[model samples]
Target: MGPEWAILGATSVSLVLGAVVGLLAIRLQGIYFAMSTLALAQMVYFYCVQASFTNGEDGIQGIPRGVAFGVWDLSTDLSMYYFVLLVCGAALLAIARLVHSPFGRIVAAVRDSEPRATSLGYNVSRYKLAVFVISAGMAGLAGAVKAIATQIASLSDVSWHMSGELLLMVLVGGLGTISGPLAGALVLIGMATYMSELREWVTVVQGLVFVVVVLSLRAGVVGSLSGLMRRRLQAAPRVSAASLPGASAHTSGAG
Candidate 1:
């Protein structure tokens, strides 16, 4: 298939898979949903390992980096990078739109208080299912994109570890924030790349970071920064008012 077609196929497949998982997960909350998704991911990983087309341990290697626009070769790193960036960007944008829509608001509402949403005549389960499916599809898309990026799709792509890693990225980057995952991905991936010699230590570092963030910073890094900015904005008016020539004098006299 053509380069664009391959990307389209990967994106579509990911969306479908994410939607399916999301649908199933949305019915349950908290740890149950997490466990269910993890199990599903493991099942997919095993399937990839056992399936003939995926080539088991050897994986589907040397996948042809197809031609883009029926002209530009995608095999080159530069071309592939741009292609991936574009696809990932588009996916992120799509997700952002979903999160901002009325439907997304309902999903958030369900997350916060399913009973309330249900009482309000909204099918909380259905919304949860829809969002779960969307997230699952996006996860699948990420898997497919990574496979294409490396030109190999193996058991590793669907492993529970991979799911855990994605969850970590979301958490570290700030769940519920559009840019968090991207930042988390970059930081983790970059660190892993640079510390290749200590690959085993990566998990330790991630765990420590997670603990620190959870214990000390309820909001992730981005969330905390956002709060700080909000506080500054809110305090600006107070500061300006206090700076007025008679403001402090009048307050002191009144006291």
Candidate 2:
């Protein structure tokens, strides 16, 4: 089967699990929501571990890099690379578009002040659930890509540690900003590649790096840089009409 079938599987998984979690979690707010969702995640992880269909901890492996739409051969590394790049690029663009759409604006509004959104007659819970489901589906899409690319899907995919790593990526990348995860991923992947020799210490070093990022770049790499640029732009002196080279002559002639 091609990648399209894989997407359908992922999408179905997301709709079922994500909707369930959203139903349970969306009514609550803040840490409560996080805890509730994580509780479900823990359940799912164990289910994956024990379930027969999931290969009982070993997971579904030996997945082939089949053709894309029966046209593009994904057997070669170069072809796979381009395929992944195209998929990722499209995902990012779609996410960006969604985040800027009116629906996104409403979601942001609901996020900032639920009471206000409610007062404005918005169905806060529905919006929260929709966004939650969409995000979960996208995450599933990522997992599908990783599984297909690596040709494996193991227990580690749904493990608690994997959840922690996902959180770390968001924190390192800047929680709400586009391109933040990409930068964070690059740093983490680069470290993993270079420090493969020190494999055991990689997690420790990652924790240390996370600590550093938390302490120093509170807004994250991309977020902090963008903030800095914005601040500089704001701080720079503004030029008045009187400061223009021809302003005096023009003003005198007018007078």
Candidate 3:
């Protein structure tokens, strides 16, 4: 298994898993959808634990650092970094395209109003299921890539905590925005990587960050910024219109 092949395999697996989870989420909606996904992920975690190939507690160690194209060595850090970036970027682009498409709009509509969408002759549940599957597939892709990157797959990859962490990442970065999760993943992963000395306190730090974001920023960072930009854009046109010569006369006459 060359490094390129390994990465490709991991990415493909993650994409399928993400799509499956996304499909499930489409049906459940709100807290129900979340809980459903969490439960499903836990089932996977247990399965991995029981599976011999996963090595249970010890995890699948010493995974081969396969070569690149029979020419480039991926055992090196630089090559591996480039490979990860390329794969992740491709996945993100796919997600972005999905979000901007008509199907994506339908999914959003289902999120906003399933009953209304159904009334409009759309099979809301089916659409939701499809999207849930897609999201799950993407998540799986991420998991597979992660496993390959670390050259190991443990029960931890499918654990509820992993799912929770992903949710938190999206929330902190700004849900409903493509870039939010990427940013959130960076911050969370970076913190975890560098805070090895304070490993015991990492949980506390993470919890505090979640608390602050939930309390002070309901929309998450990106969402809040987007809202601010929209408000400013809207206000500019209003201000300009109001300042026009006939604006005050019209307002006074109406009054």
Against the unseen true structure, what C-alpha lDDT does each candidate score? 0.77, 0.88, 0.77
Tell me each candidate's RMSD, in Å, in order: 3.5, 1.6, 4.3
Candidate 3, 29-54: lDDT as tens digits? 56896687678778877888888888
Give per-residue CA lDDT, model 1, range 1-255, as digits (tens): 675676668767777777766766766777897788778878877888888998888888987777877887888899889888888889888888888998888888887887899999997777766666666567656766677778887777767777678777778778678898787788678878887888799778878887887777667777777788999998785557779899999999999
How well does each candidate superpose onto the true structure, as a TM-score? 0.86, 0.94, 0.83
Worst 10 residues of 2 by lDDT: 3-12
Q: After superposition, how far is residue 230 of candidate 3 from its true place, in Å?
A: 2.1
| Model 2 per-residue lDDT tens digits across residues 1-255 | 788688769878987778988888888987987888888888988988888988986789888989889998988889889988988999999989999999989999987888999999999989999998998898898898888888889998887788888788878988778899888988887888899999889989999999999999999888898899999999999999999999999999999
Q: What does the lDDT read for residue 46 in candidate 1?
A: 80
Task: Identify the leading candidate in terms of TM-score.
Answer: 2
> Candidate 3, 200: how far from true, in Å?
1.7
Report how far off residue 242 is in candidate 1 (Å). 10
Better of 1 and 3 by lDDT: 1
Q: Scored by Cα lDDT, where does model 3 land?
A: 0.77
Error of 1 at 45 (Å): 1.8
